[model samples]
Target: MYRYDEFDRRFVNGRVEEFRDQVQRRLAGELTEDEFRPLRLMNGVYLQLHAYMLRVAIPYGTLSSAKLRGLAHIARRYDKGYGHFTTRQNIQFNWIRLEDVPDILDDLAKVELHAIQTSGNCIRNVSADHFASAARDELADPRVYAEILRQWSSLHPEFTYLPRKFKIAVSGSTHDRAAIQVHDIGLQIVENAAGERGFTVYVGGGLGRTPMVAKKVREFLPESELLSYCEAILRVYNQFGRRDNKYKARVKILLHEAGLDEVRRQVEEEYEDIKSRDALTLPHDEIDAIAAYFAPPAFETLPERSETLERAKVVDTALADFVARNLAPHRSPGYGIVTVSLKSVGSVPGDATAEQMEAIADLAERYSFDELRVSHEQNLVLPHVRLDDVPALFAELQKAGVATGNAGLITDSICCPGLDYCSLANARSIPLAQRISERFADLSRQHEIGDLKIKISGCINACGHHHVAHIGILGVDRKGEEFYQITLGGSGDETCSIGSIVGRGFSSDDIVDAIETVVNTYIAQRSSPEEPFLAFFRRVGEAPFKEALYGAAPAAA
Candidate 1:
């Protein structure tokens, strides 16, 4: 993790005091609600349907045990007993009091965490692969660059207010775990034929009312020019992105209106002017210094497999199931990357109680080198756990009630704080997610479904990333009644594609059955159990599933 320097400490403390005064003004009636809106948003506070919501940034999803404890303290002292982890790898407290925000910000600053840029039309928290340095196939730690971008973009005067909010994601692995393709800007670390490292840059990818996958802007931009290239892209967007209509303000909309070729041309032209500047080019030593902060943890020499884990699994079927669903191969031998599923059956997806947060902090300190990661999938990750300690960790996790072994399964869905809290939401999202999770509570059933991603959003803002899910569900209000629209064949991997709507929307009562029907239809259509839901759906388009949902697609007449 990147430690805050003296300058960082001063900057954060200054912002805390600044926001403290703003909050005091609002409470004292010196500032009206409308006047306080922009100030509050700049500090990551939102007035939701029921109460104020505070979103705190977890830079690149990395957290120290101390930082985790700090968040737990906030959850316990400030708001409700739990916080919601979002798709962007940030956390939101939904029941915050308006006057308590300053104190919360002060607590966050003490732990080197803040709500800065977690909201608003500034560069939001830069996201990266949660399995950054620990993944077996990662070319480099994307967090090194993510941290760099965070430092560069924080309070940047030039980008403080864009046409709309901007998001950037980076991935150091061949696999797109960070869902880079769906970001405003996506950078994938790649090596050229000459073995020099660079990035494959994708620009203007986003999902909302109008969803579009980013287009490749630069095939291979040298690593040294990362900042220059990113600046150039931002400059181009700022220059021409829409300002009249908020709906058409995003860079994705700009790219759609102005062709990709023209956008690339302008970005390249801007880059040519800026690339030669020493301030923009990253020096080798600076890159190395940043990377040194993320060097691998010390490891005792051991075999690849853990005999202890194997033996325990032989006796405990639950452990076996957990290992199968919740574990990922680590870059280090004799170690495993364990994903603690926050999406327990019937629970709100991506939410963790203060007690559970503290318990996870303890686990991270005791068994995972005092570091934890928040996955984009709304799960907590123990990134460097020794395989030998798996059984004990599993037991502790079981006690914490987060030992659900559904990582990429049906129950492990991505959802947003919909009508329950979000004022913009037209219908409730949590209840639907809960119902679906309980519907597929059986471990055997989830495993049989295999690598399915069900994402739900309360509205078209796409906060839950439903557009990229294998089974995307969007809640809408039809004549004051809650209904859901389903989209199938969407995915957020390397081969990214937007999902197509199956047919008409389903009533809240019938939505779960509709989802089950789609799943059953997939099972029936799959050639074998080995075929995954996504693969089968892709092989045979949405026709079969659509037919199963709305009966044969009205014979072409």
Candidate 2:
């Protein structure tokens, strides 16, 4: 929701013009593929398996109706009729023409959006809880800080090309919906003993071939020191992070090699050096200005009208389910945050057609404050919808095929594009997700199971965030055959830990059945319906599910 200032506007326009020329030069044979690769990557263009893919940054997953419409325009005109919203709170078009990328960036810039920092080995888009400013229990709006970081990191001379890609996430609430623990830098908004707002910064967390929860580098950094402290962490990483091998290039690997104490010492030293520089430390006025950009729009003062809401609840069971599952607590009295589930049964988890995007844009403009947010789970959020209008909104969303009565339910899965669109994948993830979703098509059964996170990654990169899911499924190739491996007891919250791998892998034919067996085992062993699958699993361990998947045969063990 932060409007582009004059300087920001000029910078993006200039970059678009520069990329346009670069595209022309590449087409004219003035530059080789290798020579032009970095330039194109800087503009968020990638040469994928079948075509060029353009990734557009949705900073902190925040967007206005105008910006959403711009994305829909790109999807309709430049590439296919649909675009994929990624787990990083970005959107990707898989079938872009190389020559059209500059045009796309130009169009995005017009809407105060850009593709900068969406790709390459630089600080990527900063993500936060989609319901940031609107959340009832929010300590502070993380996007206000995320936007500041986005501007500071954009085309930053020193961090333009790090050893590998870096990601950052922030959460202002106790529940870590943004999965902060698995990012390269995780900032949790906290209060000090004096009751002033600050950040608890974590560093070196990532999921790839190696998955590790970030270590706490700073206990409580003042609001004014956020930028400088982050810069300190990046400076240390850029200076000492491994560049010897691609596999060893990430800051996480560097942290692993150097140990947390050394990394912490280096960052602290760097922070001390940069802390006094005015260029690094944001002024109080500037911080207030940034915070003002996210101030909630005026809402008509009204009491909670349970009479109207209860009438709809009495008549419509589906609406009641949606009201319970889709609505989130809001800071405003009569308003609530709503997540419009794109994971309708038998549909791709994150793919939104141009029409759906337009519809969502319209809904945001009409019912909310023209504000939309792309969630880390690949869904959209209208963060300021009124509770009294829930019935009408539900009807519109249901007509658009974006309504599904599962938010934290078992079937509401998080998945990667996987082997279908990603060249890096070893096996297919979408089909696997589809199979699992179909297996739990019975809404009552899914509700009975309750609050299970099924995250699937195509390969070891963990793009699907498999390591953070309560039920993590990883797809790997064994002797040219696709097999799926299961990991249990993982979480991405205040209590973060990498999942431990279960005994063995399951064949593609057996994965759905294996997941069913795991669920059924939880159902049979659970003490009560209130016990979630994760709680039950944590209490009983993986022994029951392991036995169910691989029978009593000694080889199964």
Candidate 3:
């Protein structure tokens, strides 16, 4: 992980100190809630249903063991004994007192973490593939570019206040785990036919009220012109983006209204103007300096695979299941990328107990390279674990109640803190997620379902990424009652698509059964067990799912 340079340390400390005074002023009656709203949002603080919620950024979802401990400390001492990991690869301390927050910021700064850019209509945290340097299939570590963007966008004077929040993601892998297609600016690192690396840029993709997959405005953008090109895109949006309506302010809306061809033309015009500016054109030496911060750790050469691991899997069926389901192939021989499941049965989808966090930190320090990653699936990753250390790591995980052996299966769902915490919520997302998880608790059954993603959002804000789930559930308010709308065939990867609504929504109590019926329908309609839920849905379309949910025919109902 990148340590804070001198400038970083000073800038973060200065922000904390500035916010501390702002908080004091609000407490002393010098500032009203109206006055303090934007100030608090600037610091990543939101007033939820009951109390204030503080969101802390984990840049590119990378963290040190020490930073994990620092978060656990915050969960224990300041708020509740648990923290909720979010779909954006950030964590939220849900129950925070207004006065204790500055102190929390101070503690986070000690570990090179901050809430800066986590909220408030500026450039948000830049995310990358969690398996960055560790993935066997990745081109390079995407965090290098993510970090460069982070540094460049942090309080940039010109872009401090955009029409709305802008999200950027960098994917250095062939597989689009970072969901680059759904971001405001999606950069997929690619090599040209000449074998030189750069980015394939996508613009205007988002989920929320109007869901659209970004268009490929640029087939290939050179590495040296990254900043200048980004500036071009932002400049077009900034100058022409709508400010009359918040819902219509995003770049996606601009692209939709302007059309891709015109948007590309405007961006290219802007790019030509600023392409050679000395400040915007990043030099090779500077990129090298940034990449150095993300170089792979010292990995020892070992046998291709661990015999001990294979032997243990032969006896311990549970460990074997976990090993098969929770591990990913690593670039290094005899190493595996381990996903620590936060989705335990009956617990909230992404909530981690303080003790569990500490245990994970300890495990990372001992077995993995003292590093942790937060995935968009709301799971944690130990990116560089030795193959031989599998059993011990899984055992420790089991002890902490954090081992759920479900990743990308039905139970491992991305969900939001809906009616319980978020004021924008029309229905409770957590309870619905819990009911679905319990209904699908049988690991073998989930395996049969095979790599299904169920995402639930409290409202249309799409915090749960319901737009991308194989089975997407959106909660709505129906005459003061909780109801949920279901969608099918949505995905967040390279083949990104906005899910279609099946039909009318079911009441909260009936929603779980509706989801089960949808799954059962897919099972029966699928060509084979080998075919995943999304593939079968795309093959057959939403007709079967609708018939299953609303009876053989809605006319009969």
User: Can you write out model 3's per-residue Cα lDDT over 58-166, one digit (the tens) per residue?
Assistant: 9999989999999999999999899999878899999999999999999999988999888998999999999999998899899999999999999988888999999
> Candidate 2 — which residues are off by over 4 angstroms?
276-279, 552-557
lDDT leaderboard ranking = 1, 3, 2
Compute the lDDT of residue 252 as modeled in candidate 2: 85
**What local lDDT score does residue 62 receive in model 1, on the 0 to 100 scale?**
97
- Error of model 1, residue 253, in angstroms: 1.0
Candidate 2 lDDT by residue in tens digits, 1-557: 68988999899999999999999999999999999999999999988778999999999999999999999999999988999998899999999999888888888998988888888899999999988988877898999899888888888899998999999999999878788888899999999999988999998899888999998888999988999899999999999988888789888898999999999999988898996556687788998999998888999886765467779989998888887888987888888888998888878888999999999999999988899999888889999998888888899998788989888777788899888888888889999988888889888887788888888999999988899888899999999988999888888878887876876888899888888887888888899989987777778886787777776641431
Would you estimate the TM-scores of all the predictions?
0.99, 0.97, 0.99
RMSD of each: 1.3, 1.5, 1.2
* lDDT, candidate 1, 25-71, per-residue tens: 99999999999999999999998898999999999999999999999
The better candidate by lDDT, 1 or 3, is 1
In candidate 2, which residue pairs get closer than 3 Å at backbone N, Cα or C atoms, i.e. clash?
none
Q: Which parts of model 1 are misplaced by more than 4 Å?
A: 554-557
Question: What is the TM-score of candidate 1?
Answer: 0.99
